[model samples]
Target: MISKLELLDNLKEDTGQLWGKMSAQHMVEHLIYAVRTGNGKLNIGCFNPPDKWPTLKRFLLSSRPFPREFINPIIGENLFPLQYENLEEAKKILEEEIKDYYRYFEENRDALLLNPTFGELNGSEWEAFHEKHFTHHFSQFGLL
Candidate 1:
């Protein structure tokens, strides 16, 4: 598993040349939104029960991928941010969210957490999904 610190460090690098998608700043904001969703702070505007997930998606969510889409991404406007600015501040907030996520998982790994897009995810499932999803986006922006 990639260390969270390492992932954060990579975010400092310029991604404009590496991934012609979102600016590194916007990318950081995007990351914040993701962490918030996992922590029960933000809702992605949809729901997918754990049973509704495909076998492949459930499996892949538990580990790092060889970089293909990593895992199937859900489609919805509310799941992601429509806009953002100030990459530095966004990164700081994102880092905080990640820490909170880790703490939450550590404390409640066995508890059932309500997921906006997956009804209720047990602690392990949430960790796997959060980690894999973050890794996927980090890789997408060339920061992994």
Candidate 2:
């Protein structure tokens, strides 16, 4: 297992040559989008229904397999689509966001945020999801 900081640093070395699709710039922007969620600037979805709240909560808290459909996104929402230009600028933005996310995780290990989809999570879950999900994509790009 790699430390979060180490994994982050390693991201700088990944050139996105093997991602097969996204340019390095897009990958960096995707990372930024995830970190922005923790920073309270991005909302995953608009709202949750009362009837499905428990199901949504369980999905967030439980160790269930993520549906394959969630892999691709549809646009026209608050969520930013993963596409970017200017590789150097995107890398700089991503690096700064990751640093901010790391500090937030360290300081707010038990705080709750109103996640648009998951409802809320303590800091650990937030950090775990962010790290794991980011690593998943990075690996998809052959970064690891």
Candidate 3:
């Protein structure tokens, strides 16, 4: 699974034809939110119960790829309001957030962040989650 940020440059508003309603800018902003969550900037709680986190995290950290039709329970079927001016700006912010994530983890190795889907995650777990997530979205836009 590819997790390269450079691959995101290949996306255009019209790029993805496979499935889902996300525009290119929406996808970038989504990624920005995800990185914020991992870096403790979002400060959200997990949706799953405590008992479910172990199982969920196991699934998350596994090598299996996310299915194309899969949808998060929180994000449902609708599109979210765009947060950036445009796709380019969204991509730039996403890059900044990714840099923040690296810096955040390097400074606070033991910090635990809530992932909404995976409960509390340490830096390494968040890293794994981000990689899998980026791979999924990048593949959706044919950037893989």
Candidate 4:
């Protein structure tokens, strides 16, 4: 349950350091992309093959934390280009996307979400995934 308030509170002038190339702004923008994908705003297919989906989904939903400094297939190498002009703009957009994420589940409870790594998931699963994801990145920036 990593809320926007917590994220905003922890986002200082100097948030991230040395783990990866993404600045705090870049991390926010990256999160926005992920949220968009979860809410069905961005329709990207799963990178993992169908045979591996069950295992991937299980791991994603498990309590195990995401590994640090792992390459994200969706964001790295400018696969999905960043759109924000600055950190403030990225944060604003991410906040809006967070709101939309809740709204999306409220509207479509039975919808199957296709994550680029985790394949199909329901609304509740998507929320859990997001919580884990946000926690991971927030920690990456030493916010947690």
Candidate 5:
């Protein structure tokens, strides 16, 4: 698993992509939202389809790579509204969010975080999801 610090190191303003619509900055901001969600700072409700498709959630949570161009229902196609003015600003905020996210997990190791799609996730699960999620987008931007 690629650590967040390593991912941040590889990420650059000029990083080009082999897939997806997000610029590097957009991707960083997108990750910020995800980290925040995992830290319990953001709650967008749940997309609880586990009852309808029991194996789906387990599959997603498993050690499987996320498909390229998979539309994140929470973020959507257009991308979330920009939280910062430019790439540098976004990167700065993202770094801060990363710190906060780990801090949150440290303080509340047993907390149950709600995922929009996968329902509730514990710290370890969230860490795994984050690793996969970041790896997917980083690879998307050719950062991996």
Candidate 6:
């Protein structure tokens, strides 16, 4: 399996995905937000009820890849506005964000962060989310 950081290695800006409406750069920018979500920089409320999180988190940490065309309840069907000017910039920042995600947990060993789908998650759990998410999007662009 490719590490999340390496998932972008060969992703091209115009690559057509097996599913979804996102362009390659849009996918990269989307992933940048994901890293922020778990690293204490971005705060998002859980959409699920408190009692649902344990089951959701277990599914997130599981080996099953996210189903193609899965809808993000918080984000909906539209793509978020892209932050960087281009694909290369977005990908570069995504790499930096992934590094920050790891560094943050290293410095704050017990810190927990909120994810809109999974409630509060510790470092290891966040890592699992990242793994699943990266695989999902990378698969979208056929990068994995």
Instruction: List model 3 lDDT by residue over 72-143, tens digit each.
Output: 776788778997888888888888888889999899999999998999999889888988998888877877
Question: Residue 59, candidate 6: how far off, in angstroms?
Answer: 0.9
Model 2, 1-144: lDDT tens digits are 125434445554346545335555565676677677776667675266556766776665566544422534423323455454565677667777777766766777666665555556567667656655665666755655
The number of clashing residue pairs in each candidate reads 1, 0, 0, 0, 0, 0
- Candidate 6 residues lying further than 4 Å off, grouped into runs, are none
1-144 in candidate 1: lDDT tens per residue?
Answer: 227546656665365524334556756676666677667677655456566656545554645453542232443333355354566677777778888877777876676666555556676677676676666666766666
- On lDDT, the leading prediction is 6
User: What Cα-based lDDT does every candidate model obtain?
Assistant: 0.61, 0.59, 0.83, 0.80, 0.78, 0.84
lDDT of 5 by residue, 1-144 (tens): 225556667667788878988888888888888888987789998766647434655776787899998888876778766778888788778778878888988999889888777777888878877888888887888766
lDDT digits (tens) for residues 1-144 of candidate 4: 445346666685477654777778778888888899888899889888889988987888889998887888866655345677777888878888888988888899899988888888899888878888888878778777
Q: Tell me the deviation in Å of residue 63 in model 5.
A: 2.3
Write the residue-wise lDDT of candidate 6 on 12-130 in tens digits.
87688889988898888888888888877888778889899999988988888888998888679897887789999998888888888888999999998999888889988888888
Cα error, residue 63 of model 1, in Å, equals 4.9
State candidate 4's TM-score.
0.89
Which residue pairs clash in candidate 3? none
Cα TM-score per model: 0.66, 0.62, 0.93, 0.89, 0.87, 0.93
Cα distance off (Å), candidate 1, residue 94:
0.9
Q: Distance (Å) between predicted and true CA of 103, model 3? A: 0.6
